[model samples]
Each structure stands twice: as C-alpha cells, then as structure tokens.
Target: MFTSTERIKPDAQTIALYLENVLSHKYQIPTFQRDVVWEKENVKKLWDSIYKFYPLGSILVWKTNTKLESHREIGGIKLADNFHSHEYQYILDGQQRTTFLLTSIYGNKIANKKNFNPTLYIDLTIELTNVTDDISYAKRFLFWDEIDDRDGQIQANTGKKKPLQR
Candidate 1:
C-alpha cells in the first residue's frame, strides 16, 4: 500500500553493500526478480569497462514494504525477506555492473561463486600516472590493471571507460 521510492547512482560500490547487507538490507529483490545467471565472462567485461572510465549506467532499486514472490535457488541463498519493514524487488537494469562490482571489487560472495575473491581495491594515492578525472583521486580499477596499469592511477579500462562529459 506504500509507494515505492527509487534511488539512482552511477556504477557504484552499492552492489557490494547490498550483498553484504543481504537478508537484512533496507531493500530486497522480489520473487519476481530474474535469476542471477551472469557468468564470469560477463562480470569480467563489466569490470573491464568500468576501469576504462566508461559509464556502466545506473543501478535501479525499488524500496517498499510490500512482499513479493522470490526466485528459486536465489544465488545460492535462501529467498526469504526476513525483515518486514524492508521489502522490494531489484529491477536490475544494470546487472552486469552490479555483479562485477560486488563480487570482484568488494570480494562479496557472489551468487553461486563462493570461491571467487575480489580482485580490485581503491588505490589511495593521489599521485597518478594516467588519471584524467582532474579530481586527483584514483579508483585503482583492477579490471585490467595489467593492461591499463593499476599503480593507483585512474585508468578507464574498467568501469568509467566512457568519455568524459566535459
């Protein structure tokens, strides 16, 4: 009976937070949500694009208090919206981006991939070799570090590969 509120943000670390807070997060993927079937290749592509400074698009999530059906084998975990206050469906228009960030960057246990470890981390160094954001901060994208260089520089062979707005 409540109107759903949607939050928007570019490819972010949001996915990691969502999974980490799974079962107890402020929002939940409805049963009607599609199955998480993205393979490692898809995930790899996403991370690669992101590191390239390309726009992975924004992730859309609905937040409400209404319960809904859940998919089977929901990512190697039980599908029960344990909390009543938070109920919603993850309309994953950007599933590729979400999954990669969560599983590869944050090291979150991705659906069906318990053995995978996050390969990316924030390089907390302002001194850059190829930073183009002009923001002095680098994301240290590990997606293609070998190819793009991960020496604490903001390289866009991964998530933010798209051209800059300016």
Candidate 2:
C-alpha cells in the first residue's frame, strides 16, 4: 500500500549540503543564471529558522545528464567538474538556499559586489583553543561558529571572552 506520497521526509540539510558542494566549486550552476543576492534580514531569518529547527522549505532539484557551463570564480575559486554528468542536478527552485549556503558556509565572496559577504557570520577555531576573530576559517568550516559552552552549562557563563573557544 502506497502512503500517497506523504511518507517523504523533509530533509533540512539538503539545501545546506548542496550549497556547501556548490560553494566548494563542486557542482556548477548554469552560467546564464543570475548571481545570488539577498539582504541581511533574509539571511538572519534563515539562520534563526535553522537554529530553531524550523522547516525552511522544500527545494526542487532536477537531476539531469545535461551538462551546463559554470559561472565565474566564486570567492576566487573557479568551480570545476568532479563528477559524471549523469549525477548533475539543475536547481529548479532553491536559489535562496543556494545563496545562503554558498556565501555563509563556504565563505565565498559574492560575484556581485553590491552584496559583499553580508550573509557570512562565521568564526574559526584552531587547536581547540583559538577562535578566529582575527583569522579566517575557509578550510575549517566545521570548526567555525562554536560557542564555548563551558561543559554544557550556559548559566553564569560569559561566552564573550575566553577566545570564543575555537
């Protein structure tokens, strides 16, 4: 008995992971597509939603074998092909998610200067001690955004100092 297509689970990380891949110059988007540009409010809304575990929305992906040309360098890195054409998917309706994921997580400089890296709020951590307020975190995206929880107790804990606990 089919569940009437209601059994499909919503994947919150789908867009995020896709954006990461794209930003890392893994999957290339169509060159004719316009550059991603969203304001800080939209970005904060997304981050807040994500932090609250709210369902952002479903992203449409068109898995295709049709290869497309890549846009210019994203944050100084030229996206190159790393997989077979059959696995490629054209983003049908998730440009916003793509934008967030590329600029923030990947720390990719925007091709459009008007929107700089406004969406990025990442900080880096090094050697489990250094938080990157004075450093960059492009190679260690996972280590970024870490809060020095101080043993899982948030009470009376001043998280501002302590080097942000990288």
| Top model number, lDDT | 2
Clashing pairs in 2: none
1-166: candidate 1 lDDT, tens digit per residue: 4343334333455544656655334434555555566765566556545555676666676554656654423333344445444546554464445445545643445555555444554454434455454332223333333223447445555764433345
Least well predicted 10-residue stretch by lDDT in candidate 1: 138-147
Provide the lDDT at 157 for model 1.
52
- lDDT by residue for model 2 (123-144), tens: 2332222332322232222222
Error of 2 at 71 (Å): 2.7
Worst 10 residues of 2 by lDDT: 134-143
Backbone clashes in model 2 = 0
Q: Give TM-scores for every candidate, taking all chains together and pairing residue i with residue i.
A: 0.46, 0.53
User: In model 2, which regions exceed 4 Å deviation?
Assistant: 1-16, 23-26, 72-77, 81-84, 122-166
Model 1 scores what on Cα lDDT?
0.49
